[model samples]
Target: MNGNVEVVVVGGGYGGVTAANRLARRDGVSVTLVNPRPEFVSRIRLHQLVTGSDDAVEGFGEVLGGDVRLVVDTATRIDAAGRRVSLAGGGTLSYDYLVYAVGSGAADPGVPGVPGAAEFAHWVSDFEGAGRLRSALDTASASASVTVVGSGPTGLETAAELAEAGREVTLVCGRVLGPSLHARVRRPVARRLAELGVTVLEGAGARVTEVTRDAVQLDDGRSLPSAVTVWTAGFRVPDLAARSGLRTDADGRLLTDTTPTSVDDERIVAAGDAAVMPDHPFRMSCQAAVQLGPAAADTIRRRIAGKTPAPVRMFFAGQSLSLGRNEGVTQFSYPNDKVNALSISGRTGAGVKEIACRFTLNKLVSGARKASSRGSHGDSGNRLETPQPEHPTTPHGTRRSA
Candidate 1:
């Protein structure tokens, strides 16, 4: 490439910020990050935002690289054939390469027979929804009942946080609590929730069939009074890739080969919850997003140098769940994400969880500093070093070429 290589990173979450910083390290590479909000959202602490424990947002100046152009607007469409991205704020950006990292949000409440859920239940998956729920809680009476639907980590964290804050909380697990956790680890989590005075509802009978303004109807002919309903179930990604005629999985995540290059176009790569690497198929967690972001950026850098890009490598350490401000659990796992027997709980676990959150922010800040320092010397060979797990293991599968 004779001139500057333009790269547009869509979304400013963990993935986008990291990718922008990494790409900006190389000379003659221009990085532009397009995000709806000017501030960076720490999504891992969203549950804390609901309870007024943390703000869950940071100034973009703290995380994003100085050399990266920040576009405070939404990306409406991607014209892949023309190498252009249409913005909702009225304009188009021509890119030599694009990185798709639009994160995820709560799944819509439109179950088969579950009516009124979309209108009645509140969620805390995104920043806007979290703010709305916090306001609703402020005005509600102290005696109002709060019901959290879903047994996933989000549900567990939300229920525990609210219960610890003196709210009459009920966790309605449609089936079992911590479905993905090993049975041994789930035992301690259940004990902590019980200590916090949360009403845990399990079994088929606990499944919520309908959500109303005042109560929720269960599958087993039971009606529970719920003044504030918080839905924290599954997550759904943006439809940007699918709408743009790019190859996507059924869930609308951009379908990429092992190199994380879109099968539809080699110049378009993806990361975070918005991308699906067919061979790896990792879960949508910050653990994966932080690593995949740099991997995607590395692919673009390699292509710019006329070299073959290496396949993406991802490793998971474990699941970190904060029960509340004081208590939490760290369920360690293998690189493949299968829960192992080792675990930590109580206050020690809380410390570990807090460190993980801070580590993400620190990682971005440090990466930006390194990139900025290297850019000053006019050297493109200096690579941004991303931290790896202590015990790394190879993901089982052959690479899928784009």
Candidate 2:
């Protein structure tokens, strides 16, 4: 409305990066992205990073907008009243609008016998944890046993990666494997894990009661010999929002409306796993985060222009699971994320999964390039072209974070 509109995006994950890039497109808008690292963490591939298949990181230049200021620092607090963000690196950033996308990290339920076990257990929750797990796996004996807990995509991918690496692997599904998948779609996943030589245990009895240095005690009074225990059970969002007095869900995800604007403040918006859009929430998957990113960005733009932002339109295309480096499975699903009988497996399936990963990186880079030209020449009124799904029926996992 006046001078340059300052927008500060807290977090460098998929949602934050997308929002920053989109905001950079508007004339007279200044975008600053705050993250702990200069490089973007491709969280979807952290499992591959842990197995030495990929590094899972790239410089901001690869995806972030050229005009966007990159602040390599963690956000310690958000002052909504003052419209400033306190950083871990000892500074504060004032903003006209704040986009919160702090994201999540690994969590230990603190079950008995697991007080200081993070140091010992292999974890793939973050880059550092993935690195540690890589080192542990590299030095462990060939005969060492590895147990991966949780039946979510993360746990499934981790167990498959190690098993494909020829390690002795067991996937402990607390209740069932691929709980979100339809029984028909889950069938192929089970078959592939079997082919990979992974031991899959279902039922509550398979739940880990305690994690020791070299073993995981199951609920059924059984101690599994786990030379390396990789915990991919679940994720927990950062508490920065709740602590800042912002409205948040029970899990600490910022509570937002359809437009992803914070329920308590119109000047603040949120996206990614850290945002809980009431009744419209999806799992903490990259598929959902990417859409939320651009949607939240548009919300900020509209608000600044004295207009109401439209509801964020999110469609979950499908589930892409890489069983290993060479083989995988792509279970096609509806836009609602419900699985279908049609699917792809083996090398062909791996190809689709790899494309999904590349599409995300490419989307960010493309978004940045468009933002650069548009900001320089003024608004061209062209809609940003997002990648469409290959099959009209198969939902496309177009973009997002890990």
Task: Give the number of the best model, judged by lDDT.
Answer: 1
Candidates' C-alpha lDDT: 0.86, 0.82
lDDT of 2 at 327: 77
lDDT per residue (tens digit) for residues 1-402 in model 2: 688898989998999989888999898898888788768899999999987889999767668766777766678898899998877656677889999989888875453355435655667978888998898888999889999978788888999988988899999998889886667778878998999899999986887777788988888999899988888877888899988999888788999999989999988999799989888878797888899999999999998888889998889778888999887788788887777887788898889999999999999889878776754444222221111224311222322221
Query: Candidate 1: which pairs clash?
Result: none
Weakest 10 consecutive residues of candidate 1 by summed lDDT: 393-402
| TM-score of each prediction | 0.92, 0.90
Model 2 stretches astray by more than 4 angstroms = 111-119, 374-402
Clashes of each: 0, 1
- The prediction achieving the highest TM-score against the true structure is 1
Give the poorly placed runs of model 1, Cα more than 4 Å off.
111-113, 375-402
- Looking at model 1, residue 166 earns an lDDT score of 94
